[model samples]
Target: MQPVHIILLIVAYFSVLLFISYLTGKSANNKTFFKANNSSPWYLVAFGMIGASLSGVTFISVPGWVESQSMSYMQMVLGYIVGYAVIGLVLLPLYYRLNLTSIYTYLQDRFGNYSYKTGASFFLLSRTIGAAFRLFLVANVLQLLLFDAYGIPFWVTVSITILLIWLYTFKGGIKTIVWTDTLQTLFMLIAVGVCIYTISTEMQITNIFSYVAESELSKTFFFDDVKTGDYFWKRFLAGAFVAIVMTGLDQDMMQKNLTCKNLKDAQKNMFWFTIVLVIVNFFFLALGVLLTDYAQKNGIDAHKDQLFPIIATKGSLGLATAIFFLLGLIAAAYSSADSALTSLTTSFSIDILEIDKKKNPEEQEKTRKKIHILFSFVLIATILVFKYFIADQSVIAKIFTFAGYTYGPLLGLYAFGLFTKLQVKDKAVPFICIIAPVLTFLTNYSTIQYFNFDFEFFVLVINGVYSFLGLFLFKK
Candidate 1:
């Protein structure tokens, strides 16, 4: 596909998103932006959460990841099922009962102001990095495939990426995202299915699941390897904790769930979301197997993050594959990026500034708009940093490794708050959370350097344990 054709496809895609934004953004206030006035359908929220949770990183990187990881990522997917159950049964009830816009508010009520602020601050930092990582992958791909053809610099591409998200998301916030994400998720899934079919046909694989099962690369369980990252126990447990903190405790994800009309609706959403997410992730892995085999047979040197993009856009797969690939890539990328932008704005405005407490609607909206624009630029700059320093490794691996530290504190804070009734010194709480991650990092470094036994996915569990122990020491 030509660069001009890609640009036109993008323009048409965002036009639909903007039209959805226009319809949803009318009369949207902080309440609508933050919670969609608690009127979103449960099914839409369930479906939309898939796109946000998977993001562009999964779309492009997960299949590419199979070269090294194989289907062992499924261990984490299984773990996610357990994690989502905890959210549905445990966390969702608490959030609904308390009527919270920001889940960090629970930290305040349970611990103290400092603890609440610490929790929210960790989420802000963690999410900013996470969102930046996702956008970096997609933006880099966009730069390679389209922008570079027109002599556009990477910085210009990154800026345009952020600006486009800000355009439709500045007003409606979660309201607009609730609908736009559903559309994007649909496009993303369709693209995956189409690509799988096209490649499977060329390879003459009649029964995909059977063929995937028969192949050597289709190994899903890794019980024999305890020292590696893909081991079942490590990945499964990490996957569980990851789902809990990154989804249940995350403002961007839970923000959408909170838009549902009631706790029951939200619980139902989580149930369906979990089922679909597992199936979807399996498909991504299977697609990875196919893409890898196709690349090998045809002698395409592409591997890791470059595999899918190189094969999909190359002339061999046909024009339809290229068209859907772009649509799917954009849909998957923006589905998460747009929501991250809105949630960061929501958290900063409500959690940091407490703007929702003000009486004037206009003032609150004004504050939100400014913060919205601020995060848009924040994401833009962060993506540029990733391009410069962090572009070599697969994007998904970086996200999970980073999550082990950034989100580990959140897992600890929430676990401490919910399971324990004892109070700790408010000022001491912040110090504990900060020190926990630092110590966890030191421990992780030592384990890998000296012990030669890398904790890998278990780092989150280890970090959570450190925070839990720290909180216990400080309990009154």
Candidate 2:
């Protein structure tokens, strides 16, 4: 755990990434920069997507979650499968049929310019915040590794780290992201696997199936009698909504999916993606259960998120295991950090700013580079602002929760356009979309406070309903 070792590991990782970036960026023109010339293999996109889907927030959060609530999150993972199915069958085809450069363009065609901008704006705001929060999670870990371990200043650590992501992704955009993300996913899965092995070995639970089954944490699904608060139905609904909004409806996630050669491949990729997600999440939760049991037995004190890292860094793990664990963590963060950067730029360019129509490929490429730089700065600012002003550890989570309000509108608007023939007034669409989420939040808040109603995982459901109602009210 020497500071220099951590620095060297980071440098080595960046050096290789830089080499990859230079190699890829060399031939990058507008098409290749934006969509990898639509030449990426669907399977590669699917594998690369794991890094994007899980990110640093998920990498740390999922494992940490196992230390509490008795490893209950597995209940939601089952629901996630159902959600992905809906996305593949219902959502992906719609996106592909439209042949969209930015999916929000569908809103414009279905409704009007106002609706398109509203949807794109919501995406911009939601994605900007979401990406910032995800990156902040990674930044926090890097800061600890730097200051607590190596005494580097927080600002310097944040700057240097983000700069590296910018350097690599500033040129090739989503094309480079597809390949880099695959690399990241490989690193990420390897990291998760190493943790599973280390924790199981330390517990002397040699048989993977028996260890997971015998351990109290191995309960993968829930059938709670209660109607809410992690109940089976609630968790399932929550998982479905999470998958739909976080994956299907999200540009950041779907942008990679859309890079496939054709919609058939994209659909195939989604199916395989869902299957892989299920297996991967199962392992994370199982690891959580194992880690929790081991800690309880060994009298270890650590936060739920810190539980895995602490054990791997300080526990009975051998040197090689420890190194792999660290590398995995770094890999997960970098994998996500780069994709977020790419997606933010893509959304901004296609959805809001209209970089797709620049006409001249050369100018389009230069404009993209400028936008990438702009977003990198915005992300750095977000991390700094959150670090200094936000005292609550829950603030970041709340930002995500609040940011989620926007997705309800996205879900409702998209569902309305695809499922029904009702025409909406172009001018009023944006207002309806905005008001829907606000009303949903108010209703949700009031229900929880006055009626003794607790909608733990169904917030997005409520959000969709409110948005739908608003659309109905404002329809032409």
Candidate 3:
């Protein structure tokens, strides 16, 4: 596709999105923006969540990972099933019974003001940085495929994308997000479906199942010893814990789950969402196997992450191939990016600064708009900074590795609050949270450097232990 064509296609896509935004905003107000008046259909929230949870990173990076990483993610993802169940059974009821607009409010009721602020602040710090990183990954892909063709600067690319999200969300907030996310999810499904069909045809692979089963990359369920990282027990535990903490405890994710009308509906959504997620992830991993097999047979160089895009544009598949892949890529990126911005706005307005209670509707509206702009700029700037410092693929991966450390405190704080009745010293919570992750990193680094203990993805376990220890020792 030419630069002008891509620009036109994008413009048309955004125009349609803006129209939907306008429609969704018609009934929106302060309450509606914050929680959608608690009227959203449970199924919509469940369906829309697939897009938000999967994101552009999963869409683009996951398939690539399969060819290299022993298909171990499926094991971990199965663990997420148990994690979401815990969230649904335990966490969802608590949030619903309390009638929370912000989940962090639980801290104030249980611990103290300082605890509330500490938990909320940890969310803000981790979420702000994490949101920026997710957007940065999406922006990098957009820059490569779309912006670079026009000689547009990276910041401009980020600005335009963020501005589109802000414009749609400033008024409607969560109300608008539900409908927009559903639409994005639909687009994502269609794009993936189309791409899959196209690849199957181009490769002339009559039996995809046999291809996957016989392929060298088909190590789906790991039942090996726990001593290995990708072993069944480790991946399963990691998957479940990662999901509970990363998705269940994450404001960015739970914000959407909380929009359901009731706890039962939310639970239903969670169960259904899990089933769908398992199947969808399986499909994507299968696609990865196919991509690997096709590339090997054809003597392609096979860059792990870039394999899908390269296969999508191979000459035999023609112009529609590029169009479908671009559309899929856009859908994947925008589905997550738009929701991330909305959650940031939601969390900031309700949690961090408490902009929701300033007692002036007009001023609250004004504050919402200003913060949206502030975060929009922040997302853009982070993308530009990422581009400058970390162009190498390995470095980009490491940046994500570093960002993964932030979620440990989230896991610890929630675990401590829910499982224990001990009254934690509120003022010390934030310090403990911060110190825990830093110490975890130091321990991991030292172990790797001196002891040569090749700690796998179990860094999550290490971080969780560190946070747990910090809370125990620093308890008042």
Candidate 4:
């Protein structure tokens, strides 16, 4: 409830993570950091990926999203099931068979150096922005609820946040993250469960499920409006592609899956991760339903991104609820971020710098530590930019829209690589990737201006199609 208490909660929480890092950090090298020496347990990786996948966006934004979007996010969550299948059965096998540290290396093998560098560069840009976006949202909440009361500047809060991630992850990398993510996921789920149960009890609802089911905000499908953001098919199909690109094709996500001891283990991890992710997301949207109802009945005027935090801290939810809320938010935010930093380092080292091709292991490790610090600052700067320039939209929606541009080329390149045997003009890929997102934006703008229809959730799908066509045209 108090700023001091929140600070103490964060301190105690990271203390546990730092202790885990100490244990896991021993004998750590680039291999342990990159692939966890291919020793991570499938079950641990599966459980940890839940926290990494959701991040602070879902923790705060999803619950708040219920007021405007209702339960329509479930369509995208359902689509994730389809996407994860592609990851498990298709992408995982390919990555494992190739023994890849960075999944983008597959592009070099399939295409050439130019296409490979293009894919890797796109991933670096996408994940840097994505990770920054995730941290920015959580840091804003911290500034609002805790830091502002102490007259702390927002930049200070963000710097400290990024610094903590680097401290623990700098040594053990994914090996430490596999363990820390498990703890974070546990705290995250516990927070959600606590809030759901406490809020339902406060509202005096006898059947939580029945209450959620009966609420108008609980409406999940939107088949009638084919043009709106909430349209079922549009969201479902988009959700599948989002998962495929953001997870399967992503270095930050696939890096963890690659840590598993074998292909079967990684596949099993993806399967279970999907099942739990779907169920966990439902609880988030359900929490959103309860928060919105609670806010309305109490005459609190919050909506969108502010709904969950306002209610949890200011809406008389008690000290226990507040404590867990901060923990959950921090857990969710850092779980993904720590891995993002590591994967960025991994991708850059392997894909961009070709550190692996060199003979000196010690030199490679030194280079990685410097890159780790470099990205830590990069995240800090990006968050500062978001604070100044980002609009008042729900943060999750912002992430997906941004991904439509950043990850879309990745989807097209991978699809072109895997499905078609056509040899690509590798030199044109960097240029084609740039044009795909630009074409996507123009098409989306034209549709809205001329026909009053927007791409909404279909942004990635449209961009990917554009990218595929672009690649097809330039094929050798």
Candidate 5:
């Protein structure tokens, strides 16, 4: 495909998103932006979340991950099922009961003003970096495949990418995202399904069962090595906690759940979302096996995160496959990125700035608009930083590792709040949250150096434990 054709496709895609935004953003106010007026359908929110949860990182990186980890990522996927169940049963009811616009507000009700600010600050730091990283992946890909051909700069590519998201989401916020994400998720899944069918046909394997049975790379269980990162127990436990922190505790994710009409509907959304997420993830792993097998048989040099793009775009999979790959990549990338932008706007406006309390409704909306645009620029700057510093590691691994440090504090804070009645010296909460990650980092370094033990995602668990203990010691 020519660069012009690809550009045209992208233009058409954004046109649809803008139209959806126009419809959803009509008469949108603070309520619509923050909570979607608590009017979204349960099923729509559930279906749309599939794309947000997977994002571009999974769409591009998961298949590539198969080359190194095989189907072991499935261990985490299985763990997510249990984690989602916990969220629906435990966290959702609490949030609904409180009628919270921001989940971190729970920290305030449980502890004090300092704890509330601490939790929201952690989310801002974590989601800012995390969302930037996710957008960076897709922006880098766009620069490589399209902009470089047109002699455009990487910064320009990123600016355009972030601008498109802001265009759709700046008005309706979560309300627009509820509908836009559903559309993007559909595109993403269609792209994956088409790519899988194309590859299967090329390999002359009509039966997916036969293909899976024959491939060595399809191995899913990994109980043999307790010391390695892919150990089933480690991956499973880490996966469960990851879901709890990243989804249950995350504002970007939980915001969508909050948009549902009520607790019962939200729980229903979580139930169905978990089942579909598991099935979708299984297909991604299956696609990874196929990609790795194809690469090996054809002597493609690419491995890790490079495998999917290399095969889909440059391989002999044909033009249709390439087209779908582009669509899927954009859909998956923006699906999450759009929501991240909104959630960051929500957290900063409501939590950090206390915009709701500090301003009249008109002024709050004005302040939120500015913050939304500010974070969009922040995302662009962060992506540029990643371009300079991020080396050849898998983007997905980098994301998870970063989450281990950033989100671990959140996990600890929430755990302490929910599981215990002891109240900490409110002023000390921020220091504890900051110290937890730094201590977790030092512990991770020492253990790796002396014990030769890799904590991987379990580092999150350690960070949470340290934070929990810190709070316990500081109890008033």
Candidate 6:
């Protein structure tokens, strides 16, 4: 496809999103933006969340990850099922009982003002960097495939990308995202389905079972190596905690769940979302096998993160496959990005600014609008900064590693709050949270250097344990 055609495809896609925003943003207020007035359909939210949960990182990186890790990522996917169940059974009821606009507010009610700010600040730091990384992947791809053809700088491309997200989500917020995300999820799934079918036809695999039987990359279990990243128990446990911290504890994710009408609806959403997410992830791994096979047979020299894009855009995947890839990539990227932007806006406005206590309704809305735009620029800056420092590693792996450090404090804080009734010296909460990640990092480094034991996602567990201990020691 020509660069102009790709540009047109993106323009048409955003037009549809803007229309959804216009419809949803009508008469939207702080309630609608933050909570969607508790009116989102449970099923729509569930379906939409698959895309938001996967994001562009998964859409692009997970398939490529299969080359190195094979189907071992499924270990984490299975763990997510357990994590989501815990969220529905434990966390959802608490949030609903509290009638929370921001899930982090639970920290305040359970601990104190300092703990509340600490939790929300961690979320802001974690999601800001995480979301920026995801968007950076998509923006970098666009820069490579389209903008470089026109000599556009990376920062310009990133700014344009963030600006478009702000335009659609600036008014309706979560209200718009519930609907837009559903549409984007549909496109993402269709793109994956079509790519799978097209590749199967190209490979001349008449039987699906036969294809799996022939491929070595389809192997899923990895119990043999306790020291490696692919250990089944290690991956499974890490996956469970990751889902707990990244989705259940995350404001970016739980904001959609909060939009559902009640706890029952939110729980229903989590159940079905978990099921679909597992199935979709399985297909992504399958696609990875196909892409890697296609690359080897065709003598395409690409590995890790470069595998999928190299074949889709540069190799002989055909024009239709290219179009679907572009569509799927954008759909997946924006579905997550749009919601992250809204949730960041929601968190900062309510948690950090205390817009409710500090301002009248009219002023609260005004302040929210300003914060929403501010975060868009924040996202752009973070993405540009990432461009300077990020090295050639699996983006998905980097995201998870980064999460282990950033979200571990959150996991510990929440676990301590829910499982124990002890109140910490509230003023010390922020210090404990800050110290936890640094200590976790130093422990990881020392263990890797001396013990030759590389902790994968389990680093999150370590971080959480450290934070929990810190909180316990500081208890009043």
State every prediction's TM-score relative to the real structure.
0.99, 0.94, 0.94, 0.99, 0.99, 0.99
Candidate 3 residue runs with Cα over 4 Å from true position: 222-228, 391-400
Runs of candidate 6 with Cα error greater than 4 angstroms are none
Measured on C-alpha atoms, candidate 3 has an lDDT of: 0.76
- State, as a TM-score between 0 and 1, how close model 3 is to the true structure: 0.94
Cα-lDDT of candidate 1:
0.93
Error in Å for residue 43 of model 1: 0.4
Residue 40, candidate 4: Cα error in Å is 0.4
**Candidate 3 lDDT tens digits, 1-476:** 56676778788888988898898899677788888888889899988889887777677777778766757778878888999989999999999999988888888898788777777777666666666666776676667777898799888888887888887887788888888888888887777777777778878879878877887898877665554556777678767877886677777788887888889999999999999988888888888787777778788886666777777764355677677777767777777777777777777787877887798888987787787788788777777776666544522244335544777777777777788877777778778877887888888788768875534555766777777777777676
Candidate 3 displacement at residue 66 in angstroms: 1.9
List, in order, the clash count of every candidate structure: 0, 2, 1, 0, 0, 0
lDDT of 3 at 464: 74
TM-score of 4: 0.99
- How do the residues 1-476 of candidate 5 rate in per-residue lDDT, one tens digit apiece? 67887898899999999999999999999999999999999999999999999999999899999888888899999999888988999999999999999999999999999999988988988898888888988988888788999899999999999999999999999999999999999999999999999999999888986787678878888988787888899899999999998999999999999999999999999999999999999899899999998998899998887789889988999999999999999999999999999999999999999898964789989999999999999999999999899888789888889898999888988899889989999999889989999999999888889988788888999999999999999999
After TM-score superposition, the amount by which residue 239's alpha carbon in candidate 3 deviates from its true location, in angstroms, is 1.2
State the lDDT at 93 in candidate 5: 99
- Scored by CA lDDT, what does every candidate get? 0.93, 0.77, 0.76, 0.93, 0.93, 0.93
- Estimate, for each residue in 191-297, the C-alpha lDDT of model 6 and write its tens digit: 99989888888889788566865789888989886878788998999999999999999999999999999999999999999999999999999899999898989
TM-score winner, 3 or 6: 6
- Candidate that beats the other on lDDT, 3 or 4, i.e. the better one: 4
Stretches of candidate 2 off by over 4 Å are 225-227, 388-400
